[model samples]
Target: MLPADTESESYRFYKSLNEDILLKPNEFNEWDMQFENGDVVNVTGYESLQNAICIAIMTRFKELKNPLYADFGCRIHELIKANKSRMVEYKIELFITEVLTNMRRVKKINWIKVTDNPNNEFFKYLVEFSVTSIYDKIVEGEVNL
Candidate 1:
């Protein structure tokens, strides 16, 4: 097969994954991706693109369901909702730091220190910042700050 065909197949395989699994926030979301001929691959293969996007999102959700220490903080929402009483405040940053601490099995002070001056209100601001960063990073591959 031609080199282009091989590349096309590779794209198709990855693209098919999104379709079969239905991952959201699809490959069209990748700003860095470009086409020499200026034809967008993700937009062209629309149905499979949608599926691939959904699958990708579901995979991320699964990872969040049970995460490593670093990732647990990133997925605090899932954890708190799972065990509300265990999370005292249920505010976002509090939830993030708590879940991260539990996953690490570390003292709260350490996580707080890493988070920078972790007061309750300050932590709330940090939570908003982190969420915004995640969205920006995913959509544009650049965190706002």
Candidate 2:
């Protein structure tokens, strides 16, 4: 957990892992709820850093088709939806690299692997990547589309 004073200053200060409230008090509201045991939950430190990276990879960019929201998600999903050839795999890897390196907390992206899900008719992909955070912490995870 981050110190209360620096909670707002650090991008890694996410909502408590066990609580719905944001780490920063000013960002909290009545809508946020607490656990029955009164435990404050937030994804701080390495967890928050890793979650941010995962969200960026999973999200599609510029999803204009949905009328409700525009400019959301990454293009990798669109490429998969189009049923592109093997080259799409390379593109997904590049996109993940581009997105992660651009983030302030992401120091470097070690590697990215994009594999097709043969069982899925939609050409879904299984994404796995490792990144070095600014704090020198290495985080890695896989996302299945």
Q: Look at candidate 1 and tell me the lDDT of residue 10.
A: 32
- Tens digits of per-residue lDDT for model 1 on 96-130? 44443332112222222123223543322222211
Using lDDT as the measure, which candidate wins? 2
Winning candidate number (TM-score): 2
- TM-score, predicted candidate 1 vs. hidden true structure: 0.21
Deviating ranges (above 4 Å) for candidate 1: 1-90, 110-124, 127-145
Clash total of candidate 1:
11
Query: Whole-model lDDT, candidate 1?
Result: 0.30
TM-score of 2: 0.61
Q: Write the per-residue lDDT of candidate 2 for residues 1-145, one digit (tens) a residue.
A: 4223344434334333211232221222112323434655445556566656666555677644776546445666667555566787888887777777667777788888887774574546778888887767688876665
TM-scores, each model vs. reference: 0.21, 0.61
Give per-residue lDDT, candidate 2, residue 14. Answer: 32
Cα error, candidate 2, residue 9 (Å): 17
